[model samples]
Target: MTRNVARNRSPFSIWLAVISLCTAGLVGTYVLFVEAPPPRRIVIATGGKDGAYYRFAQLYANLLKSEGITLEVRSTQGSVENLKLLMDDDSDVRVAFVQTGIANSEQCDSLEALASLYREPLWIFYRGSKGIDRLTQLKQQRIAIGPEGSGTRGIALQLLKANGLGEKDDEFSALAGNLAAEALERGEIDVAFFVAGVDAKYVRKLLRDPEIHLAELTHAEAYERQFRFLSAVKIDEGLLDLQQNIPSHQIVLIAPAATLVAHRSLHPALVSLLLKVATKVHQQGDLLSNVGEFPSPKLTDLPLNPEAERYFRSGPPVLQRFMPFWLASMLDRLKIMIIPLIMLLMPLMRVAPPLVRWQTRRKIYLWYAELRRIDLRSIDGMTIEEADSSLEHLHRLEQQIARIGVPLSYMEEYYNLRLHLNLVRSRVLSILRGEAGHSQPGSHPGFRTEGGESTLAR
Candidate 1:
């Protein structure tokens, strides 16, 4: 019973050791395979309450929230300030809705566009009697160039200044979207400019009234020539209201596209997810946009992220669906570990049998050394009984070789070495018993004599 207990305990102990080893291996594998933690929440830098960016964020925030992602929409001074927030480390803001023409300076870095949400049309509305045929006409007039630090203000100031107008040329008022539109309607301002997306809610309400008239960019071609980034778009004469035929002629407008920009450090999976969401939110049939019309990764002030570039062309990875976001992240991290694993595992599977054969034949090889020694003793004319004792030692070694445990993969080579050991043992014994004369070690007698002399001398 005690023997039985000990035997049972031995296997248990071995199993425990195996379990411990496997557990350690599993833990190490998990450490290597485990994914990074997902981001807790994302902060989006949007424009002020009355602008298109803030309204767009409301929709995007809803879309991202549905994907288990929290979006903190922080109101800012529009594109320029949004870019600043993205650059500032303490802000923790990850994404921004920036109008394209705003970021003109060279100080920006580590930014990439996820997609172009919409075209931020530079809506220039003037009081009917101001007699403004071009942007230059607004010179020396009371003009509201949008709020300070706003995207509209930045682009408006730049465009008007190109036509030789600035704060000095006109009575510039820095006011919010609703406030500016209201001031223009009340005749408090001669002209008001809003660089916002198409059918801007506030601008539309003002345009519907008879008191305010929408200004057309008569010099759109010249504007596009001066600013290559600006595109000359024509708002059809009655496109806004086909039945009413509201405008008498086509309205030519110079506009900049709005870009969905993010920091370069954003995870590829997250970028892919954002891009996917942007596609669904912007490209799909929504109130303000049409199908196949949005989420363009092209209109950005900064360079495109490589993943965003690839995703724009090829789309998302398949493993992203089945794998957790964090796990998919790990595959990207350990991209280098794959080569070493393949190299090490291949030789282990292929050469294991050879390694076992080498080990099993080691004892048999040792006996060959002994047989050589006994053969030398016979060559030196040692007595038969003395040589027999060496033969007996070799026989014991042969028995020991047969008792060794080796897997069947190595059995052929093991048995072949055993056969060689037996044949050599018999040959040495026959010579020792004087049953056969001296057999040369090989074909060379001088080499054999020298080898035998050296063995006897040793």
Candidate 2:
């Protein structure tokens, strides 16, 4: 009884070994060939100290870390420097929040956009002896265009040049936004030109002071015409507040839209995830964007990524909308795995049955060959005595096949092959007993006669 139990377990043990090897091969294939998760740490190129970009980057850093992403918000001069960092692979920076119209045309090839966060209104406040309402009035005064390589400086230069003014015509100072505002308050700088989002701390402080007036762009329409990138917007009276009743009249401003730019090599999954986070962060009903409307890819030098463009047009994918954040992220990483899994499973399901039958029937088919050999030898003008001996050999072959063991899994195909062997045996016996005619002229009982030959013999 113990010997029989060991014999039964031998096949199971062999199959277990085969399945173990197959499982190992499958796991190794998935690990080596499937898509990998994104880098754990990333750098977010932002602006210098005390700027709007730097503050926003801090918020972004906090938000990303919650999603298992480490963000290094590196401070620099501003937009131009941010673009440079993303374009240089040696820096290992992947993303940047850049202002539009400040980037060089050549740098655009290395960088594209993920989203445009908000519009950066250029707020030029001047505390001069003369009351100035237009940019043309600052032609000869010492004006601070913002720090060198800063987004403010880049926009300041263009706005001045648009109004038929240049650094040669006016004295230009390269100072940070807060520094410029303090200098203008101290009566050191004649005018301060700041390009930043609304609610910039230094700008708010300057707005409350009675000594300084927010310079309105009287030539806003003309400026927008000259520089197509500039948008003319009006700051309505008491728009900042209802109680202060400040700016009793409307203030016109010329501004450029701030865009979110990154390297073209950024992963598509990361872009999708970033856009999902940005939608939550920026789509609120604030002074900048309306509810359910933000993080747009509408304005940028480089074209939007194909997947991002599709997502913006349609909305978040189904898995993202319903699944938890981390699960959705894992599903995004496993996007390519779906294809390989289907490819692996579908064929196994279709061909396993036939494959198992072919493997198990090897010994059964060997007996059929022995029966055929004996029938051929007896057909060489043998007497009835020789024919009876051949019939005995055929019977023994059939008994051996009937006694062979087959597992339950392959029982159907195993029985079908046996049925075919039985049919062949019956026809061979009838021919030997002279109950059926062998014909080269027509189809025979044992096999079809094609081209004057049996199909099996041929």
Candidate 3:
């Protein structure tokens, strides 16, 4: 009885071991191949504290905080400095807002673009009465081209060089931002260059100042044709302050796109989250861009990241559409393991049932082989003592077979083996009754039928 109980428990134990091993293998696979969770904190290189880049970075910081990520905005001079920070190997800055044409493909091989946030128009505010309409007209006049390392200065030098101006000309000043605006108002400089968003306070203040005048780039399309990175935009009359009808006439402007760039190794989940934030913050229409025009894949100088491309083609990752941010991030990390795990299970699914079936029937087949051996021996002569011993052995085999546990699906085979056992037992009993005549101790026993043929004859 104890042996029977042990036999029944064997298969269950084997199956338990197999399942446990499979679970362990799957966990190991996940640990080895799946990506770790995204970092909880990241640093972004932004422009001056009061500039448009800094303001937008603050908004992104607030939005990311709700998703359990902390955004650290590091203040810098402008796009030129921001690009430098992103390229430095030891710097903590993972992302930055850079202006178009600041870094070319050769200079930014380690960077990729997420999206172009908006267009930054080059506003040339001057305090002059001679009606300066083109860049060439500012030849010998004192011009504030913004401080060094500022995007405003970079673009100003390029435009000034296109016209008949150079560094040798002593009239260029390094003033920028509010300082440039104050200098223009006080007549310290004849013209001041500003590359800022329409919503900047200083730009708005200068636009409404009666003493100041905004230069209309009458040849803006020509400039765009010359500089592929520049786009021709128009500031519609009175769009800045509709109530007071500021800028009473339409102003033609040429601008460069501002793109959000990151290191090539940045986490893909963070890229998706940043793209989502950019869409919310920059999708509204402004003086330089129509609604939904910004945060686009256009006007980028760097190669777009694959994750960002997927976001532009579809929306966020499919899992993120229905779940919270943290849960969705975990699931996204696990997605790479799903296919390999399914492949691992496929063969097991096909082979497990057959293995179990074989194990269940193995004991029954082993007993059947023993019964066949006893039947063959009974056909030959045996002493009476030996015949009684053989009968007892047959009874013992039957008791063993009866105790075995067979599942309902295999009952037919079980019953067939039992019938065969009974036939062998009857043959042994006939030998004991002298139905099979034994001539001598060493001779073979033969059983005669009604037709007088030997039953043991082949």
Q: Model 2 over residues 61-169: C-alpha lDDT tens digits?
A: 7887877777788989888888778877798888888887887657467777777777788888888446787777887788898777788888888777867898776
lDDT of 2 at 237: 87
Q: What is the C-alpha lDDT of each candidate?
A: 0.70, 0.71, 0.83
Clashing pairs in model 2, backbone N/Cα/C closer than 3 A: none
The TM-score values for the models, in the order shown, are 0.69, 0.73, 0.79
Candidate 3, poorest ten consecutive residues by summed lDDT: 1-10
- Higher-TM-score candidate of 1 and 2: 2
Query: Candidate 1 residues 12-106, lDDT tens each?
Result: 34344445555565556557775555585888899887667888788877877766778888998888889888888877988898887776536
What residue runs in model 3 are displaced by over 4 Å at the alpha carbon? 1-38, 326-339, 366-406, 411-458
RMSD of 1: 11.0
Q: Rank all candidate structures by their lDDT, best first, as comma-separated numbers.
A: 3, 2, 1
| Top TM-score hit | 3
The regions of model 2 sitting more than 4 angstroms off are 1-36, 324-330, 333-347, 363-405, 408-458
Error of 2 at 444 (Å): 48
How well does model 3 score by local distance difference test?
Answer: 0.83
Q: Tell me the TM-score of model 1.
A: 0.69
